[model samples]
Target: MHPQPESGTGTTAGLPATADGRTSSAPPSGPAPAGAPDDGRMTWYVYLAIVISTFGGLIFGYDTGVAGGAAGFVADDYGLSSFMEGVVVSTSLFGGMVGAMAGGPLGDRYGRRPVLLLSGLLFTAGALISAFAPGLAVLLAARVVLGAGVGAASVLVPVYIAELAPARIRGALVSGYQLLTTLGIVLAYGVNALFGAGQAWRWSLGLAAVPGLLLAGGVLLVPESPRWLVSRGRLEAARDLLRRVRGRHDVEAELHEIRAVHRQEARAGSGGWRELNASWVRPMVLVGVLVAFFANGCGINLVIYFAPQILQSAGMGSSSSLLATVGLGAVNVVFTVVGMALVDRVGRKPLLLAGAVGMTVTLGALAVVVSVPGLPGANWLSFACLSLYIVMYAVSPGLVAYVVISEIFPLHVRAKATGVATFVIFATNLVIGLTSLPMLDRLGTATTFCLFTAVCVLFVLFCLRMPETKGRTLEELEARFRAAADSRAHARVSRGV
Candidate 1:
């Protein structure tokens, strides 16, 4: 049987103790304030917080997608070779790698809110600098800075939403981040088309600042993650915020559960690289890192960052390629919506398994179609395959990666673990972004796609080791892992190993 959390009593910390003995400094219990709706569907503040946090996702999507289209124009204007183009496009991902590494520790130490605010500022600054950069060096520098913000947001936004949302709808709410990301990609495609004629890639690059600035301001109105507050021993603050977001729900029971988990974590050790040595944490972190690594290894970035280039190679004109990219973006958004609706209802593992199967099939077909000489309508066939690939990806790894990483780790180590995983993701992305153009030039498109197809086949094997995480509370999931770890340790001791 799972262990139940012990009830908290009088405060041991500096904060005032609640009636239950947990530390608290909130005002006495009261009814919902006037003008704050009490209908229990979810307060306006909850919805507002979600909307504000997801702007970061929107910024993430725009910055990443803009590069795919902007690179062509920038290459034309600057007279760039394949290597130089790779540097320009991959620079932001390098920044993202740094951001993901740093954002985790900072978010864990400070709070999710402050880190998000800083990310927004960085996003704004980076966008403006990129838009007006006079030389390739300046553009690369600007993109790195902008990429840092995207990286930070990628790590933080999903965690923030996961913490705030109720378990019942957590999948749907977390997928909102992915949804906004798709919207941002769609917007970038439209912007790319608008400026493609004039080679005004600057406008395409610069426009990301608009959402960046809005996110910076909008986050100011949202509350900090209650879980973060609770971890810091700000019990009253956590309780008050929980009540506000959870409406008429019993905040006390949830608070007690969190308190029990935190106490358990404290006994385990303050979470860090050291704590990760524990058998329980190792499996979770390993899975998280593998998921992040393989998500990129599947070559989604190849599609998003170089769709136009790929299409052009398949005998399409520049205009036709750009239009097809726009179509790809549309398919991404539509299918992502479908995934979001099903995430909560159908569960996470099924979607992941299904997506793996679909991608493997489509990517394999793409390789064959491209490799075969003189195949009729091969270009259109490749296009159809690419579209289907996005559909499969959107349903599974694309949406599931963010949701799973945020959900799997213990609360104490969440930020740090997520940071490590996201760092792996962007680092992998950086390698892919840098090498894709050169690989295409050297290895040819068919061979390159076959390599990606192989990765998908490997990913299917990886999914077999993954645990289904749908519908379980964060506390429950953590306990389950802890129990398994304990069992393994006991068996080892019995064997005198």
Candidate 2:
């Protein structure tokens, strides 16, 4: 049913496919051959798309991080109880969960670009409402509105980059979303420190509007995802966009590869939720969901949203705690750069395994340091441990999780599948955000961190089961996963499970 490509064309020779759909050989790197036109590396338009779309990430980071410091002032301003504080802080994540669930179907139906543009508008409106909200209820409503944009951007931005980037630099390019997220968080921390003492949480919460407006306006200038265009049977449009992004490369071969895979899926009736019931589809979706869930379950958001509170508990003053949070933000941004640099060369799995081990050790150490009473330099020790934890997280799971989730699914269901995975992420985030303050108040800091440490240990085991996706084309990765999924299904039938 699928159209065949011309012989000796389409896919390159070195990256061979196995009986299972995975690529058997490593993808080629660096410049193209001597006779080739350009290296097919990044072009101006590609850079533009990446920069513009990732502003959504900036909004994601700012809105999420601003709440950390803003929550204290908000509590003061509204006389919020601990329970109410948690409610206010977590309402956005609930909205994010809703947005993520909707993003996939909407993005798949319309396109990645329109969904992104809509996210920017939602983000802008939410920020303004949050900044100007007169009461706790209004603030909560505004947070939910803002959160929807964050959730949609979370699913759509990485998918956009992954779909657009050339295979050679795809890992690095996709990681840009995470990198910008950290940068936005760092910006929020700086803003929080500047305003923490002045009853200026309104400024901190509302500053997100600037980036939201920028993103909303900027996305209009970029092209839509070539893959999305092809999926809609807009062959010429897909070709033109691919040429713009990829430049002098052989567009026909790439187009054929995309079309061939899409055609195969079409014949197999593989779209929407019903197709997910197929045995092969289930594993990929499961892996994506687990990866998204565990990324949050490891208690990253606990530190992210409650770093100031965590420091305050460790005997630091409000000013000192806000300053310490800035340090944590700095560490996050710096090590995220480390992740961006190494992801393409060192691969995704190793980084994840390393980060998990490092987080377990750091969180356990932080718990012990904080739990001991009257210990010398305990506050500073906690800061050090927290910084190290941020480094470990930023360098590994923080970045790789987004990249892997974006890369693992087949193209046809990618938007829907990513939406599902992102929903799991936000759901986990909502639970953590809501429970973090209460957990600290009721269970104590040491016990709370020990719980997170345990989750990191579980994550290490999860990483062992994940496939490596670096240095491969989207088409190759899709085939490999399908093959592996089929093989597992056959084995399951053999066992009568």
- Model 1: colliding residue pairs: 9-21, 10-21
Q: What's the TM for model 1?
A: 0.92
Compared with the true structure, model 2 gives a TM-score of 0.91
List ranges where model 1 is wrong by over 4 Å: 1-41
Give Cα-based local distance difference scores for all models. Answer: 0.85, 0.86
Query: Listing every candidate in turn, what is its Cα RMSD in Å to the true structure after a full C-alpha superposition?
Result: 5.3, 6.4
Q: Which ten residues in a row have the lowest lDDT in candidate 2?
A: 1-10
TM values, all candidates: 0.92, 0.91
Model 2, global lDDT = 0.86
Clashes of 2: 3
| Tens-digit lDDT track of model 2 for 1-497 | 22222223334333444555443322233433344222447889999999999998899888778887788788887898887888888888998998999999899989999999999999899999999998888989989988999899999999999999887788888989998999999999999999877879999988999999989999999999998887886666777787788876466667667767787788677487777666677788888998898888999999999998888888888788888888899899999999999999999999988999999999999999999998888888999999999999999989999999998888888998999999999899889988999899999999999999999999999998888998888888888877987888799999999
lDDT of 1 by residue, 391-434 (tens): 99998888888899989999988988898899999899889988
